[model samples]
Target: MTSLVRSIWGEPEERKLLFKIDFFVLSFVCLQYFSNYLDRANLTNAYVSGMKEALGMTGHDFNNVNSMFTVGYTIAQIPQNLLLQVIPARILFPVNTLIWGCLTMVTAAATHVRHLYVIRFFQGMAEASTFVGAHYIMGSWYKDSELGTRGAIFSSSAQIATIFSGVLQGFIQVPLAVFIVSWLQRPSTKNLDQLHGIAGFRWLFIICGLITVPIAIYGFIFFPDTPETTTAKYFTEEVGLAFILFCVP
Candidate 1:
């Protein structure tokens, strides 16, 4: 078994190093991407579920809100990528994640369309670091022969999240819908206030935002940046040196 594993994955020492990198680096980035997509997709779910009527939004308002997010994402992409050269990924990635998480939570409180426009725009700016930045970090760690698979895995997280957002919304909506219908048939207005009048869409944003913050905290503590500059204890100097040497032509 050991010989077969070595034949496919290289010697034991290199295999151990690769495992560490995948655990600390790839796992965090994939989870971050997953959370990012969850936040992004929740808006559409919210809009359809009840946000449109609650906020009194009309045609083109939704489109414009999306445009605001796109504008912020596009404007920040170049600058954010450039910053990766100077700022450490550990600092940059986590900070960006934290910012977006807060913005997502703030979306739950939006009383007007204008509030969504502003919050989504800034959310896009914060999320601009994720997709491309994950690729950049993966390239820093994985060899050319190993990168393609890792990149594919990273990209797939977004698709999984897109599917998951719909499923999660469905799970939240079904039971609540039943309860609301039953409550409406009741004679008493008593305990109706206990529901706090929070819309289903609002809960979607709140849940997604809550899911994002811990990912940022994980990145801050475990993301290894580049092998050259990593501070992760598991990625010792010897392993870093060997990894760098292996990458040299």
Candidate 2:
């Protein structure tokens, strides 16, 4: 069993390097992607939870808003990839994430469906690089044999976050309901909508933004650029040079 595992994972030194890469690269990207998925999916929650009625959204308003986001995503995807060639992943990924988080926070202030359209468009543009950029960074650090496992982990983080977003919404709603009851109550009003005139949709965006912005900060501090360009404290010059030599055909 030990020999079989070693055969599958390479020698001890390779395994150590793999472990470091997983810790530095996969872990940070997983966290960033988790926040990205949460922010992306929370729009649906916002729509159903209170945004539609608050903004007087009707007809195909939801579809149109989604379409606006898709347009931004499509427009930015190629450009974002091109930009990544010139910018370091550590700088590019975190900066985009921070911008997206700010956009998500701005989403909480949306007063109309048009506001949503604008915010979602830019939000989508900000997030356009996350998935593709992470994949590109993963490829830079991982060998072909290691990519399958790391890729699976990176991809699944988003799915797990989708489920967590619902739970996060639930948690946000609890505090929001309390706040509404305590501060928004009127003599003639029995519910938040009657007193505050809006559902708690705004809070959802704010909380998601808060979650995202901190992770972006963390990413800037810890995210490994690429093996070739990384400044990770553990992966010294000798290790990086050795790895480069090992990869040459």
Candidate 3:
């Protein structure tokens, strides 16, 4: 019984390598997932808060925007995943993240529903790689039994971001209201229907974009591409070789 348990659980060195993989891969992927969801859902918050009125949106404009995003996301899914095979994930993942984050920031400049449709569509294409790509990287590092739990943790990050999105909007509103009233010399935005102040719903997109950009940069610098391709110093040559040999099969 003891021998069986030891064989399944792995030796101490194997456990240590697993921890390292989990810490680096899981943390980066999870943060990226969180930011991705936050960017996706912020539009809803913006619409209800002020963006809909500000853009003169009517009828099914909001739904149309979402549909455009979904269309772009669906279209990119296969190509992006296939591209992942040819490109280094360290480059592909972060570049995709940077593109989406830039598109998210550009949402601040949208003056009409048409503009939103365009931005969201391209943003969707940029983000299409994240979940699948991250899963691929995780699979490269973690064993079959280990993959499920880590994947669950990574997927749950999106839900966590959903919860965090509302709080982030509320938190941003407070400081923005203060800055507008005190520094920008604008009237209190409390009763405004359509956003007239400098710090409108646009800031939500901008802030989310800013937060995502840094994370993307971090991933570019530190995210281990895969066991076979990674050059991160933390994963020494021996560690990398062991992980590839252990997990590749």
Q: Which is the leading candidate under lDDT?
A: 1
Off by over 4 Å in 3: 1-10, 175-196, 241-249
Per-prediction TM-score: 0.87, 0.84, 0.85
Instruction: Extract clashing residue pairs from model 3.
Output: none
Q: Write the per-residue lDDT of candidate 1 for residues 35-147, one digit (tens) a residue.
A: 99998899898888888988999999999999999999999999999999999999999999999988998998899999999998998899998999899899888889999
Ranking by TM-score: 1, 3, 2
Please list the residue runs of candidate 1 whose C-alpha ends up more than 4 Å from where it truly belongs after superposition. Answer: 1-10, 176-194, 247-249
The segments of candidate 2 whose C-alpha lies over 4 angstroms from its true place after superposition are: 1-10, 175-199
Give the C-alpha miss distance for residue 35 in model 3, angstroms. 0.9
Candidate 3 or 1, higher lDDT = 1
Every candidate's lDDT: 0.83, 0.80, 0.81
Worst 10 residues of 3 by lDDT: 185-194
